[model samples]
Target chain A: MFRETTVNTALVAILVAVPLVAQAAGEPFIITLATKVAIFAMAGVGLNIALGYGGLVSFGHAAFFGIGGYAAGILASHAQSYTPLMTWPFAIGGTQQMLIIWPVALAASGIAALVIGALSLRTSGVYFIMITLAFAQMVFYFAVSWPAYGGEDGLPIYVRDKFPGLNTLDPLQFFAVAFACFLLAVLVSVVLSRSRFGLALQGARQNVERVRAVGIDPYRLRLVAFVISGMITGLAGALYADLNRFVSPSMLSWQTSGEIMVFVILGGVGRHFGPLAGAALFILLEHELGSVSEYWQFLLGLLLLLVVLFAHGGLIGVLTRRPHRD
Target chain B: MTDPVLEIRKLTKRFGALTVSDGIDFDLRPGEIHALIGPNGAGKSTLIKQICGELHPDAGAILFSGRDLAGEGSVARARRGLARTFQVSSVAPEFTALQNVVLAVQGASGATFRFLRPALGDAALTGPARAFMERVGLSGRENVPASILSHGERRRLELAMALAMEPRVFLLDEPMAGLGPEGSQEMTAILSDLRHEAPILLVEHDMDAVFTLADRISVLVYGRIIATGTVDEIRANAEVQSAYLGDDA
Candidate 1:
């Protein structure tokens, strides 16, 4: 317990401290990168709930991520344009509040997850992966064709959304928000993995028949896990849009789903701080290695191969001496 | 007579040209181990599956606690107090024996949807789970992962998990499948004690264990119940001898 905590705490501390040190040295760009790492890690954390614990290899989670991005983008646009989202249904208007947009993003993505999960979970293995990827593609195409929001060109937020007390435009302040969301996602993941629902989810992942024989409906458990996972990823999407000040169909693309999967795999699937570590290593590699060569992704592929071939549990597993009990 | 805890009537199943379960009728009265003995292709597993709602019978009625279980899924049947152990030892391989039993206890407790609270720390679940593990002779191996346990231990863990469900009927399929002499003897003793708690629909190959623990013995051949009677009665029957018991009789 102590060793695991020490490792996880060190990772969190370094993630939090490195950006602070960079910001102190007037290198705000490093802080921005840190914010990206935090946001993307949150996204990985979301996917881990379903993929890691529930054993759902959702190749289309970019749907939830992109939906969240759009939620942030569209809402902030309406708030900027001084246009009401809907005049009917009691005159609903858009707000630039981060608190409001986060919940809305979560709801939108969660509903999307419910619909997709309801259908996709009916199948398993390669078929399940394909169905999820297909659903994500459908969303990607819809986003591209919806010209009202710039279509393939994508929507942009004129200004970052406002937090209650912080200047979200300030890179440091925004990093704090992203970090808090990261921590919240981590806490939720940890709490969930120890809960009855989480136990059932993990059990279903291990053996669906055994879970069913125990009188717990594996489908319902998985669906709920998927929905929750989508909501967390969706919240991260909202943060990502604010960070980039853009929401594009690219965000909903299959590539985005693969990147999120990379984060989980690179750190350690189902490990507590796996996403955070994975995201940090990923961003560092992309930044440091991209500056060195255009073939940085090739190096990444090599690293991932080594990890998969040697480190069955990913980076954390390689780093930690003992295997983590799920 | 009072209604049996579990009753099957005219159960029939056909897989293309073969009839796996052919118009079978059976019942389990409360607190009696009714053993079903049959040869390899005689459809014992198929019948167990049909009873456990894993397979749908082409024609039949399965009444549990006098309620007809038609179109009910395995999970629904399990929730309705019909628990089962597999022919092969099956438990959550990654989980500890305690965690596996705790999951079962949580299911039986009807609070599986409760999130936020740590199930590992829940005395309500872990307490009963520990008790069930102890009852199955797995007290010291509570923290051991099910995968690392020996085959007999895994079988015991299966029983522990089934016990945690607080089942009213146990449809155990070959609970003694891979046991050695000592393990089989221990399993026979455990099952003999289990029958008094809830009637078991035991399907077994071990003649010694079956003859020792079975409150009533039923011989199945080609999906048909050829005979149902006491141990002496089944032993005395010439047809049972020639068809099944053979030189052992």
Candidate 2:
């Protein structure tokens, strides 16, 4: 049996090594796929903070993901068209720099999460899940109907956003950026899970009454966790849109939320590298199984059912052979 | 003889057809164990809830340290040094015993917002938490997860958490409920020593524990205090005997 840190280190090594090997083999497509895994894993890491650590079970994280995507999409589009995003309100303009766009994306998603979490956290269990789902649906519909940023048709970026000291247009260069973000998100998740706030949040998850009895307001703790979670997922969304050079209402759809959740569940909820493992497995399955049959998702669904029924703690849990701390 | 640290004036709560709390006036003085004893369905639990701000009293003024607690919630009340243990031993089962106490210590310190420093590594939280665990006779079981602990140990863990808060009043609900005879004796010993740290408002079904530790006893029957007196006075009261103590005394 290996320590969890050993397992986590190996998982990170695999994620890094796979992309580097692909770049060496001149398989840029594989590098792109690995980059997608990094971005999606980053989103899963975000959702895990709220859903796993906080026990929030939010099902509307796609709203933050889409907000991040649109922040990049709208900003890059505005920059390309040589138009200001707003003429009034101090003449705000868009930028194509990833450095600038990342902050906008994070702030937008964080604010959205704050508003949604404030209202949604008032309810718990199934109601919390449903309310979050409903909020994400509202965002999806708004993106679909709004005419400003291509509405239902979606918006496209002609060029990928720029990051200083690197050529983001190169597949390996872009993977570096996404991989760095993923590592940072993982770092934040790990640090937060061990902190004082983490203890209270996890305590609130296990027993809200006990947490309140100890003089900590569980609501505020959860709200802060939710916001941080959304911000991380939002950053992933920005990188995701940049990867494909496009943003769409589909990014805000409930399917996206479910997919992000699958990554966490498949890897191991609350496990430090759970999302990364889950996302990697998901992408591998999608790629390998899709090439074999059109009904690849059917196989994925079966695997998910097996994981839920038998594995208990997902892939990491099965590998570690330890029961997850509830 | 001194001022009551907690004073409840005419606290009343009605669940539509039935009144759970019927204008209950209660108080806990400094440095004394005030035991609230009652039969099942006598609203002892309801009174505890109202005092701890879990349930809203229909009408009443709860004064803690001479300030009215009109609309404060459970968290606010707890922060103001009103510590309580549940009858069912509520704890984070996933957390280690030390972590549970550390959480209480952190809550008391009002620094739960610290996001980077690892909680277990910090001597400040773990130091007091470890001492509280030792105080409650859970010294060597610091690293044991709350779920696997024996029922009696969970009870002690809850006590350690309350103690870590450095509370002014201890609202202990049936601290001896599920313990065996030996476990109950140990708990009684621990609780007897605890009163020196802070006054206690004990709700218990175990008559032996109540008689042994209570400085004063208040017998509640059907949401009303039937008797409030010394052990001998309560034993001699005919109304209390028929209403509660009866053959059990």
Candidate 3:
């Protein structure tokens, strides 16, 4: 069997090569699809931190993702219309810069995570999952009902947000930006997995009693992980909004949460590059199978069942034939 | 003699109509293996839980050193140098033996928020972690995952984790519960030497090991201490013998 590191390197190389090849071939649609994979993979990476490492099976990560999307959409829209987001409390204005947008998105999602995680983490196992789903539903309904930013119709950015040097309008350039964020998310996952906090978080997941016995509050550890996870996913959501130039209430839906989780489970929960593999596979299947049949999701469901039943570690597990290790 | 490291004053806990711990007073000295021996379902586990802040006693003050531990949670108690090993080995099964010790070391160091630096490679954590593993006679098996380690090895790993904390007191709940004769003897020897590092509140069923290792024995029955004395005194006490030791004595 190939070493996991070798497999991980190959995965990263493939992801990078696919986009470049598409760009070179003048297949802008393929580049866009690849960019979507990267953004979705980044979101999966965020969920993996809390779900895989911290054992917090959050079912409402869509709340953070949508919050991030809205952050970008609201900001860019405000900037375009030359309207301040808020006139009071020191006058917070919206910006079209990716740099500013990313932070705002991250902060928004992070705060939402802190609130949701604080309440959701008070319950464990099934209850935790349910509460998270409930919170995401709340966010989804709020997005749908609110008229400020298109509500159920969703909000759109007239133009893509600006990065420091890149032409955000170009598909290939946007792919590069999305891919960088994806790689950074992967790096953060790797660093976190090997760090002290990662150890405690993993330990808490494995045995909450033991973690407490070791003098670390598992709740606090989980809460912190949830916040970081939210921020990463939120950043991805911001990028995703830029890629589509739109933010919708659907992003906050429970289906989005389930899809993000599917990426993690399909790729390999806890594996550093699991999300990337899962996201790529998901996007590839959607593109290929969508052309073959309208019921592509049914085939996807069958594949997910197979992965869960046979490959407990997901795609990475199948490739490596080993369980995930810190 | 030297002002008990842990002093429990009239600790009482009642679950509905059942009193699991009834005004129990206990003390663990600074350098003695104070063994609390009792029969099955005699609330030995409940008393241990109360001391470790897992189960809050309805009444009584648990003083660690000189400060009262009333509202402090188990995590806080553990952080204050009160380490414990579970009856069933509770080390993180997915973690390597070395990683388990490293976690304990990290917990002891009070810097769990440190991210970016790899924990396994850090000299500060691994160095002491390695020493603890070595001290527990698991030097060669440091990299072995805890899940696959032999039952005895898992016990040692738990001990290594506890030792990594450099605790003030070791709340060892049945450390020899599942061990074979040889494993028990090995654990007995390790624990006999462990008292010098910190005092121990041993809750065990193995009488032979208890008699061999305990500096003082406290016989608990029906949620109360019936006898608290040296090994010889405990062996001679008729109430303790009839209540718990019985045919074993």
lDDT of 1 at A293: 99
TM-scores, all candidates, are 0.98, 0.99, 0.98
Give the range where candidate 2 chain A is weakest over 10 consecutive residues by summed lDDT.
A317-326
User: What stretches of model 3 exceed 4 Å from their correct place?
Assistant: none
Whose DockQ is greatest here? 2
TM-score of chain A of 3: 0.99
Candidate 2: list runs displaced more than 4 Å: none
lDDT of 2 by residue, A61-156 (tens): 999999999999999999999999999758878899999999999999999999999999999999999999999999999999999999999999
| lDDT for predicted candidate 1 compared with the true structure | 0.92
Interface RMSD for each predicted structure: 0.8, 0.6, 0.7
List, for all models, the DockQ compared with the true complex.
0.88, 0.92, 0.88
Ranked by DockQ, top first: 2, 3, 1
Q: Looking at candidate 2, what is the lDDT of residue B90?
A: 99
Alpha-carbon RMSD to native, per candidate: 1.2, 1.1, 1.2
